[model samples]
Target: METPERGLLARLDGFFFVLAGLAAVYLAYLTLREGITPGWPMLLVVVFWVLVSYLVLPRVHRILSRVYVPDYFIGRTRTADGLLGDPVNLALMGSPTQVHHALRAAGWTRADDLSLASGWRIVTSTLTRRSYPQAPVSPLFLFRRRQDFAYQQEVDGSPSQRHHVRFWACPDGWFLPGGLRVDWLAAGTYDRSVGLSLFTLQITHKIGADVDIERDHVVATVTAADGTATVRVLPDFFTGYHSRNGGGDLIETDGHLPIIDLSRVDVAGAPEAALPVVRIGRPVQTVVGSLMTSVRGIVYAALSSLALIGSRDADEVTAATSVLLALVLGLGALGDLVLAAATFAGHNWSRLLLCASSVLGVASVVAERLVGNLGGPLHEGLLPLATSVLVLLALSSDSAREYALGRRRRRPAPADQPS
Candidate 1:
């Protein structure tokens, strides 16, 4: 049976496929009308579209999930079971020890132990907390009061079975103050050490928290054996919020810690610990990028209009220019809309849209060039220049700058610190 999450993901995948098809059809129409050979350009566009659709979108979705989807694992586990259950569940949650034991029991000498991390490792906590207010305010609210809350009673005299789990590769192998908890296990149990390890690697290395961008500081706490650890994050850590009630706090940290080589220890798991990925700050970047890209398209349309103003057959030039303008503006608008949808859509579709747009842009440029209507030297030169300038501007924007700088600084320091 398909779980709700699986259904939602399926719908999202279908939606993007439809969107890509529409964008491609529109681009094809313009290409054919302009009497251009849609060979290399079309192929490149389709390839790019597929890459964005399959690869970039999935990665972006993962990043977003890590940011916004708190309790991501809980949801993901459900979906994985719904899609390819037996194998995926085993691969995702199965312990190396369990696999090794099973293989050994089956008389296999090659069975090896896989050391994996599991359980919740708080990547970076934002001021935002999931709330279940009694009243229904916005449909946009994810954890509505109508769902995600429940009550249960123990009927048997037997005590509830408690599951042991451990969080590996935590920044300092320490828990936040009053953050750890334990509870009875109603679901099946497997060592989550691997999941914890993968989660830590993703947050600390592969996927970055948006705090590296929006906030001017990076705060990370590492716990030592003594349970006394210091954080070496930026000076501006936790500066975004003051109190959950009101106001804000200015948090800071320097990227240096006293804790080292904190090993894993067994502990009980909590209900909240099973929650899937929670993403924060990713949507802001997507929305901002989409808006800026759309604005550039509008500017491009204006330029095209001005260029066609004084021709012998002004009507024809104007019509053709309008068609081109519509293509650019329409695609830009669609891209922005898709990006906006992504904010609530629980998936990343912007990459696919971007790829499609890029493909179409290239095709349009080539088509315009082939038909004598690309204007003289100025028009020919301007298009490429405009595209290059836009790309550069997009790269240099505030969000992109922060992301780049954050990534650079996240790397290990040189052998010697400069005096």
Candidate 2:
């Protein structure tokens, strides 16, 4: 069961991530539609699309994720790029040490964090037909962040094929149905081969046709080592079904979420700590800056389109007029950067300042229409106006309000010594 607020936020998150991905695809289509016509112009467009999709969009999603993605357990997790990913098919009830001991005893090695060095190592290992028992797994998101950690086992002496599962420590006070309680939730999947994504054409892992096999394998291994632990199956927790993952690979599952109780494993250590609630303002400015950076290409195009603004030929355009136009564009860009900085520094006044800018944008567009000077289908203020609205919405979200007002509880002070 989900609260109304959580439900609404989840829907918004889904919409934003999906739409942003589609926007990237649309940009790619616009750039490559001419079948890669010869010239530096075409090359630049392709390069720009790659940067926006692969880099800029991910940053935007990460920044906004705190606002719209719920901070509690959900049945499924998201991919690093915000696409819906593997289902949460397993839960563990135990201290972190117990879980760690059981998994290691069962022969599963904790995967390395995905970084440039590890990524390159895996690529080279695969090319050389060597084994990489602890290769890193691609990131998957739960609780609006990437998995806390992952564990994997190489298969058939191949670096390209493996079984992996990502774990996320459950939020404080979260509970499951049927009196079930867990300290960690996980989504396990098996990689059968490497292939290109049908949607984005990016090279990625292709999972085996059945994910249930790996899910059961995980349960069996843990139980074999920790026989005292209990096992409970939530029948049809996600009805057994078939679907495609973010990379468009076929997936099938039995839908039973197996809850493994390792509390009796006698492993003495601290349980996994719940994550603290992060204030929204910390990342909002970065999000704004990334959005602006993504659209800088559009700004450049608009500048180029003004080549003949004041005169027919390029040389006839007056120096004063050119300087004035350039100044206007530069100032606009500078304003965004300044606002981002101010917001990050916790100045609530900066948000109001941006809201005022949005109002001005609307007024200017209306005036242009009234004066019958709306020469183009899309007005100059359109992008800025849209951006202003989005910024206002982000700043006004409940999380942002809490952050702006500094409403969080402070830690208790240490007891004073006798005077």
Candidate 3:
């Protein structure tokens, strides 16, 4: 019997393979339309297939999760007792003076310490505690325009924390996880951590009361019987996204404080669990997907190359067709490559590239349509030209050289170097 976490993980894996199969079928459609050549090399097809499986699959996962999943899962919150729940809890229940003293002792400088009005305390506590509500669970239909999943964490007969994760499933079997927002309440001075974990994800605030505004990730402050030590827990996504965007963060008291862990639980004997594996038996599926993508790319490249050779004489139709084909192929290929880079680099640049490519493609298409070239190839080809330009920009050795040299110039001069 698989644990809930393990079961969910397996389900996700199966979902990915199913997605890959769909991609293969789509690719087959494209290949069949163009017809496969007898001379098509098997090795080339195999290599392309591997790239689609390894590279394209991951990208698709990220895009789907972001575009489809709900905002609730993307936003997470976890709270626990700080300083081992001894001094902090004591101070919280103690007089205002005592709490102030405790805060001072914990190296917290209260620049604006004021007692919250009546009923404020309840609201604040409610925000920090993790509690779940009793409600009938429903299938999170990915096919629907709006899908929602709600889970609550409860303690002492009161709701302590609540989570509402939502997502939208596209026709491509991609779940765009969005609307992941969390709310909690911690009674007294409790240790707490909350943030999102995704591919090239970012945290913009501190997790503790004595927040350090300069930091980008969560760092826990530990207070023991002897002394206090600040610790940091790295963030990672748990589910609803690809591994690049899949990581989890630990947020609980370091000592013997009660902690609640709330996440997706895959119930045993679920019908989805019994679904047969689809990708393993269909090797030809991936092959077809790979070939289709490759043929599309080659055709686009060939057309673009032709345009470059005879760009002057080519009628607007030919130019547009070549450009449009190239743009589609280039954007698809580059999108995959950029996502792969983002997975490894975990930087902001990957997102920028992806966004730029998407925007450029849309803009070109809109421009062509609005400019009265609806049937003309030029309108269609503009995106391909832009894609080619972007690809060249990305692959250019000169750009890389300039970037390296620029970084070197920005580095501080060594003390040994004549100051």
lDDT of each: 0.30, 0.66, 0.31
lDDT of 2 by residue, 56-131 (tens): 4553555565467665555778776455578888999887777777888789998998877999998998888799
Predicted candidate 3 versus true structure: per-residue lDDT over 1-419, tens digit per residue: 76796566445444433333343333333233223334543333543444344334434444454455453422222111000111111001222232223233434332211124423443444466523233211112222212222222222533322211221212333332332221111122211333432322222111233211101111111132113222222233222221111222223222211111111222234223121122212122222323333444566556556555564577998867767766665666554554434422323243234334434543555465567556423323533533432332222212222332344445678999964
**What is the Cα-based lDDT of residue 58 in candidate 2?**
51
Worst 10 residues of 1 by lDDT: 80-89
lDDT of 3 at 107: 40
* TM-score on alpha carbons, each prediction: 0.24, 0.61, 0.20
Candidate 1 residue lDDT tens string, 1-419: 98797577446444443333333343334433333334444444443444344333333343344355445222112111011010000111123333223223323233111212111211111112221111111001111111111111111211121111111212223332234211111111211111111211121111112212211111111132223222222232122321110001122222221112212322224122232243233334445445556555566556555554533356886767766766665565565555535422323344334434544554555566676566433323433433422332233223333443344345577779752
Question: What ranges in model 1 sit over 4 Å off?
Answer: 1-285, 288-296, 308-419
Which model, 1 or 3, shows the larger lDDT?
Answer: 3
Best by TM-score, which number? 2
Q: Put the candidates in lDDT order, highest first.
A: 2, 3, 1
What TM-score number comes out for model 1?
0.24
lDDT of 1 at 274: 33
RMSD of candidates 1 onward, in order: 21.9, 8.5, 23.4
Off by over 4 Å in 2: 1-26, 33-35, 40-74, 80-82, 114-132, 143-145, 156-158, 268-337, 343-419
